[model samples]
Target: MILSCIKRVSCGRIRPVLTRFLRASTAKHHDLESYLQFLQTQANVATESTYYKGLLYEYTVQHALKKLIGISPLTRCGGTGDNGIDLMGSWNIQKAKKKLDSLTILVQCKASKTKTGARLFREMEGVHSYHVSKSRQEGRTLLIVAAPSAITKQGFAQFQTTDVPILYCQINRVQPIYDTKQDTFRIDNFEHYSVVQGLLANHAAQALLEKCDLSTAKINVLMKGNSVEHKKASPPVVQKITLT
Candidate 1:
C-alpha cells in the first residue's frame, strides 16, 4: 500500500497537493524569517554598550532555549556567577509505573565578533566541571556560544576536539535588499532558523522531546476517554431517480 501511494505521488497524480504543500511551506519560512529580522533589529539597537551586549546575548540564548525546548532556564546575569555558567535548566521525564527522571542542561553564551577558540571551550569545561562537582548534580551539559558572526574554522576544529559538548549558534548578518518597484528596503538571510534547527536536532533536545511523548500519550488517552458525543438523528428517506 505504501509503495502504491509513493508510485502515485511519483507519477505526478498528486502534483497539485505537492504544489500546495510547497507553497504553504514557503509561506511559513518567510514568516519565520520576518520574525527573526525583527528580533535582530531589536538586538542591534539594544546592545549599544559592551556590558549590554553581553547581557543581551545571554538573554537571547535563554529565550531561544526556552522557546525551542519548552523549558525555562535560570539566567545568571550580573555579579560573580557560578564559574561561567549563564543558563541552566532541567527536563522532567515521567514514565508509566516508573520513577520520574530529570535531565539538567548548562549553557554558556558568548556574543563576540571574534571567533571562539579552544581556550574558551576549555574555560567553559573547567567552569562546568567545578559547578557539577560543587552541586553534585550529574546530568548532560551543553555549551552554547551565541555569536553575532560565524565561528572560525580553527574555533570549530577546537570545538570538535573538546571533551565537553558544545553547540555553536551563529547569527548571520542580514543583507539589505532594495525593492525598486516598491521603493522599500527588504532584509535577506535568517540565520536564526538554522540556529533553532541545530538546537532542535541536538541529542539533548531529542531526549527532552522523547520524555514529552509520554505526557502527550497520556493526554491523548484522557482526551479520547472524555471525547464529546453527538446525538444521533433519524435518516431522511432517499429519493429514487427514474430511469429514462
Candidate 2:
C-alpha cells in the first residue's frame, strides 16, 4: 500500500529494497533531516514544541543584534506605577578615533514565559504615544518590545497594527546558569528582555537629551513586583540612575 504511494510519487517505479531501507531508518529516528524536510515540504504538521522553538530562535537573533550595538541591556525597568518606558540605554557606535555619543533607546521587556501576541505591542504603543507623553514631543524616540521566551506569529502580525515607531526585540533560548563560585544565577537570555526595554527607553532619553542640547542622559527604573531580597539588607534589583 505504501509502495503504491511511492510509485505514484516516483513515476511508477518501486525499488523494494530502497523503500524498506528508508522506512526502517525513519522508524528508528535516524533520518531527522529527511523528516524535517518532509514536514517543510508538506506544511501540515503543527507541533506546539516546534512552534515554540522557532519563536525562541527568532528572538535570540534579535538579542544578538542588540548586544552588538552596545546597548546596556536590562531586565525590567518600568514598574507598574511608571509609564510604559521599561528599559533604557544607548549604543556607543564607534566613529573616527573617539567613541561617538550614545544613541539613547527605550525598551519594553516581555517576560511572560509564554506566547505573546499583538496586544502586547499595541499596549506599548499606547504607553509611548500618550501615557508617556515626554518621549514623543522630543522627536528622537523609539518604542521597543522584547519577548525572550516566546513570540507567537500573531504577535509579529501585531507589530503592523500600529505606527507608533517601536523596535521589536524577541529573545529565544532561555537557559539558567548557576555559578557556584559567585553564588549567583545569571540568565543567558537576559538580553532578550533588557534590549527591548532599553531600546524604547533610549528613544525617550535621547529625545530629552537632544532637546536640552545635552550629550548624556539617564533613566529611572521602576517595578511592580517585589525584589528577590524583598527589601532586606540588599536593595531591590530595580533602582534609578542617570546615564551619560
Candidate 3:
C-alpha cells in the first residue's frame, strides 16, 4: 500500500509479490530499493508537512500582530535551525518602560492540534534564554510565544514566573479565536495587556497614539470575557535601533 501510494506505477502485479515476500520474511536485499525509496519519500513528506504547518502559522501570526499593534509586516523566520524563533519584527513607541522602542519583536508560534502545554515551549525557551543573556550587550528585545490553541492552565502557570509572555492567540482561521469569519486577529488573553499596551501606546504622535488606542480598545472589548487576573511581567529590554 505504501509503495502504491508513493509510485505512480501499477502495483497490481508487485502487490502480491510484496505480500508473499513479507509473509515469507526472506532476506532479499536486491528488492529493498523500492522499500527504501518509500521510506525516504514518506520521511520527506512528513518533514515538509511539519515545516509547512509551522510556516503557515508563523505568517498568520505575524499578520495578526500587525493588525493588533499597528505595525508593518514582520519577517517570517521559521525554518530548520531557526532556534525555534518564528517571527521577527520591530515595535515602535514614544517611550517604553526600558527606554526603548520595543527594539525587536521575537515571536515563536506553536500550531499544535492539542492543548498547548509547557512542553511545547521547550525549544522557544532556549531561544529566549540566548537573547536574555545578550540583552545587556544589545538593545531591548520582546520575546513572545503565541500558542493559537487553548493553553492548558498548567501551561499558563509554567510561564507565570518567567519573563517570557505566553500569548493565547490563534495563528489560523480555524481556531475559532475571534470572528473567524474574517481574516482578523484579535488577542483574547488579557494577562499581558500591560506589556502589549505599552508597546502600542505610540505616544510619539497624537495620531499614532489614537490609532493604537483604538486598536487596543477593540482588543480589550473582544477579550474582556477571557480576561483573567493580571500579572506584572518582568521588564523586557528592547530598543528600536533597527530591525532587518
TM-score, one value per model: 0.48, 0.41, 0.48
For model 2, the stretches where C-alpha displacement exceeds 4 angstroms are 1-66, 73-76, 95-102, 131-138, 173-175, 181-244
Better of 1 and 2 by TM-score: 1
- Candidate order by TM-score, decreasing, is 3, 1, 2
Model 3: lDDT equals: 0.41
Task: Give the alpha carbon lDDT tens digit for every residue of 83-147 in model 3.
Answer: 55666556664433433343455677776767756676555456666644443413244455665
TM-score of model 1 vs. true structure: 0.48
Model 3 stretches with alpha carbons more than 4 Å out = 1-48, 94-98, 137-139, 165-168, 174-244
Considering summed lDDT, which 10 consecutive residues are worst modelled in model 3? 1-10
| Candidate 2 lDDT over residue span 1-244, tens digit each | 1221121111122122112111222242222222333444443545456443443333343344444344443222333343555444444434444322434455655555676676787787767655334532224444556554444567655655565555544444454344668655443433422322222223333444444343222121212121233343232221212121
Q: How far is candidate 3 from the true structure (C-alpha RMSD, Å)?
A: 19.1
Deviating ranges (above 4 Å) for candidate 1: 1-47, 93-101, 133-135, 171-244
Count of backbone clashes for each model? 0, 25, 5
Q: Which is superior by lDDT, 2 or 3?
A: 3
Q: What TM-score quantifies how close candidate 2 is to the native fold?
A: 0.41
